[model samples]
Target: MDTKRISYLYDRYQSNSLTALELEELGMLANSQEFDSHFEVVFNKIWEELKHEEVHKMGIEAEQAQVDFILSHPRPKTRRLKFIHKIVAAAAVLIVVFAAGLFYRSFQSAQTMQPAYAIVPGKQGATLTLASGKQIKLSDASKGKLANEAGIEIIKSADGSLIYQIKDAGTGTSGMFNTLTTAKGETYQVRLPDGTVVQLNADSKLSYATSLNAAGERRVELIGEGYFDVAKDKAHPFIVKTATQQIQVLGTHFNINAYADENVTRTTLLEGSVKVFSAGTQKMLVPGEQASTRENQLSISKADLESAVAWKNGEFVFTGQPIDEIMRLLSRWYNVEVEFKGPPTKEEFEGTAFKEKDITEVLELLELTGAVHFKIEGRKIIVTK
Candidate 1:
């Protein structure tokens, strides 16, 4: 496009004179393959010179300004103009260069704007709530009797999870109940009265009744992450409920991850079969299949059983996910603050690391991707250019 034509488009866009379709066309022109390199150069100018005061207040406008400016000016006309025009054009070039520098600095500033809250994993030595509404501390003696309710006794096994089983012969009906909770850095396992087992992950809770002898279905509540091996009792089914999902099973092994901070709640089946219901929808999951619920929609897809359940077995895995997302997961599990000190780029990572690895070692391995640099000061990780 000629200088005059480009200038006209620039003015129109700067003043919001273009229609929606025209704006889209302008974006297409600005983001064209040939203009990709110089796109930022043009964007900085329009954003600084023409962006409205109110528009500038919105956090997103800086990015929009960059896009709009690129469409407004294609190339400089320094070679064709007279001395005075050339001088004016030279001054504009200097201004554009100066603005680019400021944009880069501002981009650096944007990286440090961290989320106020983080979803963290559970720690060892977490507490549990008994059927009597009694809270028991788990740090000292590993094994203890929790409670007896409805002819069933809830006990903490030598291992971390709570177990509910029938205690004595009884003619009347009775049930036991207990809940297991983990702090920000722990994992625990529980075996139900019906020979079913559950592994509780960090920052997680599981509530279950003691008696499988009841005529009704077996039910449990989950908060964070857990792997369940439901014992088969066709007459009595097992049901696991979370904030947004429910899993019903006759006899199956599966993992439910419904951490509040996570955008999606996932149910991964390992063996047998399960019916996952949520958001007014239901789907049966076969072994090696997974169900994901996001924004009140449920989707089912085949999955890798070993990879999905790896956390229960003690490992961390990433599957071509963005750096920021990976950092968020790390922050939760390790209980640390993650801050970035430079420009943010769309970079993804794929790898596995042991959950036992310290925060520094994990950051070092991530730095190997040449995508980010990290400086760890105690529990805080500062990401840099």
Candidate 2:
């Protein structure tokens, strides 16, 4: 039967009015990726219809539910349509996994996964640009007052963290700004004037005013990824400004991934609450929720918190990422060049690897999956199918 016919049969099944013959016919389509995707859309609508809650988890449960309900057919003494193939039901039920598991499928295809040379991983160190334009290499700079900007003392702690203290509150200019930046293969941690701790990922920047505004708002602009543990100030809300979105919070722990190259800017909240807004959309996120902003629209969804914060805690949660997206992240964190011989691997991958491990070790894990192969030459990685 044509896809339209299959779709019609599936619709009837979803509405709880399908015959056993149609059920077997539709089950055969489960092995088809295109058909599965179509079924995913159909089941998403059914989940919404269920009205138990938003279809936040994987969408497979709905598919399995239909199968289970059909198998539990209770009408006795009724002439049942005999199925031609019993295996169809089992295969269809197994295919009912949700999108959350999209990138985590069992690997079906394999290739060599080796790299030419190892690249050093990024570490906790960044450069600080004071309001006076004086540069301090935070990695090499010793503890103590590194510089002063607008009356705020820029202190480099012995522990390699940067801090801004209002040494002479009445003497410093309140509106001046300072910037903290991490280069490729680097990271940084800093405390703002109000004691908010920020953890910056590789190739990121954070710019903020040295003092809170008189209007009672703590504002900072982010250009890459950063995790924020905001200090409580009910009277002064903390706002993280990105190019296309703004996240406002009273006191919360959140992570913002606002890389310029990414089409969607993501804000994942881990603690308390946060409000994300753009041109015409706004969303308030609770713990374990994430907001993705693209093209002036903001969408909310349940997030894999462990994956979202993995980098901040020194690991990479490689789940369902294609070769291209995977290389881009490695390029930033390891400061290396990457080229692909063919189209990037579209398969999803999973594993937890340390960020501090040699880049080769990380690539080894990817190779073990047989998803793709990597060859490095003079710091350049060539990806092959």
Candidate 3:
């Protein structure tokens, strides 16, 4: 009835490495209503971990085969087990079946011909362009003060974050400006001089004045996706400008996706309030609301805050998003090219992947959906139905 032992046995069973004694112990525990609560908690935890590790999805045919195998296997007869215990036992069997299916697919993959290619994931890196047009590759810069301009010190923190600290408040308001850009396969975080913090996604850019309030307003121009936690400054409202819209806030936490390739610009508010303006139209957004601008028109709706800011939290969350759009995101983060062999499928994907995983693992997870397959050649990924 020990939770840890139950978890260990479950894992071993999934991997097909459980010994006869352990299997018997797990089966006995599964038939007992005394540990029904423990079993439920462990079941949920294991399911989440499997999904997080990108091994939850499997082909329908393979899953059905595993289910058949499970049904044919002998089970100990139990008359006193409660209904809840029966459900728990059934759920545990399903988890083991899926895990077996995943293992079978992995073995099949390994038996196939191997390729000579690999693509890694993105990491923390950016290019900082000072007001004087001097570019600093932040990835190569040491952890210390990189530059001093107009009484503001630009330092790379020990954790690889870009920080702007004021050396002299009197001289902080210079007319100079700076820009931070992240190339493909890179992301970066910055603490601006005005105490605001921003996390830039891959293939993005942010331009702002060194003092942040030089133009009588704290404004920044964004070229791609970015998460902003604006510092509270009643005297100077924070403004974020994109190609299609501008967001104004006194202080708020929000995420903006305005990639040039994307058709619409989406701004999701997480805390406080923000006013989004585009083409003479504007909408005020409360927390958990999203404002989307397309073709000079603006609209508001409920927001999926977790999916909106997943990248900033080192995750890739997809909620019924098309494969093409998903490929676009992977292309940026993996610094690779994607080609469709023929007509693209209309299938959509719904799952969560860690941004830190390699491109191959993610592709394998997607392949489990059976809606698409992939072939990697050098840095290119070819998609096919």
Candidate 4:
């Protein structure tokens, strides 16, 4: 309960070295009657010092190795462990599960329902910088031009989307570098110079080289959600990169839900072909097939394209989906916190609703199935019997 023990457990948690027994004990202490309130106070203070940004770059194996080590080696009980250690140990366990998957129930149950995890959607907007280091923030401004950057005019449409075109130059090979970011609850569509139409979902960012090079393939890094309708370039393949997975495609229309908070990176193909690779695993998805990767494992199944892309079309659709999974989807898009008040039920729902529907209405529909109930306080949804 003191700082010393907190430091020890914090170190072990960061390094992924806490044993299963220690982790369970830590979980208990976090939600225990004696220390629940003060635990959060000490845990947050120490967490700021121990946070690491470099962990995202490592492969899935490294994460698993850490988890495996913890489960294999049990540490001895130490009265020396601090109270702060116990609180943070609880948070660290949830973080591990999130990186290892997308969601976990125990952590969800421990928190009071609030919109702690919800985020607002990002609209179509960007800042373009010219070669001269001058910047332009696009809106309905400057004739939708991002200024002439290296002789390529960076243009934004009325919809706040971006595109690049050569200006006052022969078939010269010149382009401008730009980045696109989407906030929570928003989505945008863009046609790349290569004719690839990319639909970026909320809380996602993408950056591409300004000029398309005469190269082996085209590559782009993704930090959130996006749907790709790639223009077929037989000589050049399109590659989508995430923190832990890579998706390669020729010409295809597919949606990728790979939010950093999600436990799995899902690639659902509507047409053409996509090959998903992670660590030592590879799975090729054909039209109507979907591939999902979690903790370095692969799963592929026949998919309903309409259901996969309902969000892009401004709707929510679930067909015989489990309650836990449905909560995951709602948590991200609605940007609300979820707390389970009891043991998870044997309940699942089949329904559809427009994204434009009031959050309460959607919850009402779920309640009709007689499986669950929801409480809304501001942006939070508390799950109850």
Best by TM-score: 3
Count of clashes, each model: 16, 5, 0, 15
Tell me the tens digit of each residue's lDDT in model 4 across 1-385: 5545544654565565887776665666545554433444454454454343344344435554654564465432211111122333444543333333212133333223223443343245444444355656554355566556444566677666766675644432334345666655556676676778888876677766555432467777788888898989988899988876789987889988888877887789988888889767888888899888888788888887887898888777776666777776777666666778886566555556767654654665465334566666677677876
Model 1 over residues 177-234: C-alpha lDDT tens digits? 6678877676777777778888887778887764554557888889998998888899
- The most accurate candidate by lDDT is 3
Scanning candidate 2 in windows of ten residues, the lowest lDDT window is 102-111
- Candidate 3 local lDDT, 1-385, one digit each (tens): 6888877876786576877787667666766665556756676676555444333354434544654665566423211111112333344454543433332343233223124755789999999999989999999999999999888899999999999998876776657889999999999999999899999999999999887887567999999999999999988999999999999999989999999999989999999999999879888999999999888888899999889999988888887788889999999999999999998778767767788877876786676555677877778888888
Candidate 3 least-lDDT 10 residues: 76-85
Off by over 4 Å in 3: 1-117, 172-174
Model 4 accuracy (lDDT, Cα): 0.63
- lDDT of model number 1: 0.66
Clash number for model 3? 0
Which one wins by TM-score: 2 or 3? Answer: 3
User: Whole-model lDDT, candidate 2?
Assistant: 0.73
Error of 2 at 217 (Å): 1.0
Each prediction's TM-score versus the true structure: 0.63, 0.69, 0.74, 0.60
